[model samples]
Target: MNAHAATDTAASSTTALPLKEQLVLVTGGARGLGAAISAAFLDAGAKVVVNYRSSSQAAEELAAAFPGQALALQADVRDAAGLKDLAAAAAEHFGRPITTLVNNALVDFSFNADARSKADELSAEELTAQFAGSVLAPVAAIQAVLPSMRQAGFGRIVNIGTNLFQHPVVPYHDYTATKAALLSLTRTFADDLGPEGINVNMVSGGLLRTTDASAATPEEVFDLIASGTPLRRVTSPAELADAVLFFASPLSRGVTGQNLIVDGGLVKG
Candidate 1:
């Protein structure tokens, strides 16, 4: 969509759903960066549905603290059938269709530079499994929420990505390839759905300092990154969540199909 069209839509949607009343569904919202993003949205007055494959206790605690504003739902992103059930449950519990969707779930967090794997070494099954969590799941969630979003003439889709896809400092072949594919999907989806008044974008970050996903990274490696990074430090979940909020808010109505990197300027491109 052109800038003019997007601007018009944003102005019209200003009061459609107040920040606290909008229904937002965040995948992998039980912990880590996902949990941080959930908290940011709730703080902005959005009613959030935290989707967790596991980590039920963590999800419950978050929901309890954000009472009447957050709901915890369990569904594996890789399972299309399960995602359908998740959508139904979210709609029932929130009493409103989801207006915002965040795809933040990942399958595995392997960052071993010593491990060697080439295209030839990867099997068809391995490739499919990787894409199922990284690409297919987000696409499915977008499809599930499109009808309601289109009817309402407002939607925000934020897909979480990784910095490795951009810098390739670590040779996580399967992981990097799948995330790159997801970036492509994000752009194409934005082009296709922009006419329906939906904005789709991505937030890519480097090695986060204190998340379960980043526990595998050796301390020395993190220190090396901190030394070389322009910011001279690792990123935090809250910092990344702030970037996400900008995309989900009215401020980013004109932004879509772009990868906003929050890696402390580690990857300039």
Candidate 2:
């Protein structure tokens, strides 16, 4: 079949398997925002593969809550072989192909504006590391799951981005630049994969109220951000996770190659 025809085939095939039946693999799903995303998928009645590099205890604990519906696997997102193994193991355990992927893993980063490396002080190594985790990792993951998704003719790839791309309130130079690059990948991937019935999009969130990475943020900074937003409150991990669910869910079937900002109206895009 042609690319367009194949997409139609995949679209028609997906109607039989709703969100509740989807098999979702979330990278770095053992803690913080990753944990929330895993929980959101599980709560929606989808089988989740929680992939974590470390944080075994956290990953297992989160999976334990859902019993048979969730599984915790170990894999570094930057490793293509590991990601491929993770996909195979998840399918073997869940008895189905992975239908959705959430690229949420990020390198170790803190939200302390004061501690940020200034432009002149930043090193190429720092940018390279962020690129590995933020951009290359997602690329590896998408490659690992492409065969299954293409065969099934249905896939949802949601990349976790940052509001810093639009509003560079804090110069997290390395982190923000990599995320911007990921957004470019998001759009290009959407165009390339849409013909195969895969929807690639991005969810960019502001400084969350509390995540492991944001734990070091000053109280005043949080308040300052909240006061500047229309919601007058910081966004929660759960709230951001829900937006991911929307993309994974059938409700967003027609939407692709777009970036949805879920930061309490902080950065309107």
Q: What is the C-alpha lDDT of each candidate?
A: 0.85, 0.91
lDDT tens digits by residue: candidate 2, 61-139: 9999999999999998999999999999999998889999999998777888889899889999999999999999999
- How many clashing residue pairs appear in each of the predictions shown? 2, 0
Candidate 2, lDDT over the whole model: 0.91
For model 2, what is the alpha-carbon lDDT of residue 79?
Answer: 95
- TM-score of each predicted structure versus truth: 0.91, 0.95
TM-score attained by model 2: 0.95
> Largest TM-score belongs to which candidate?
2
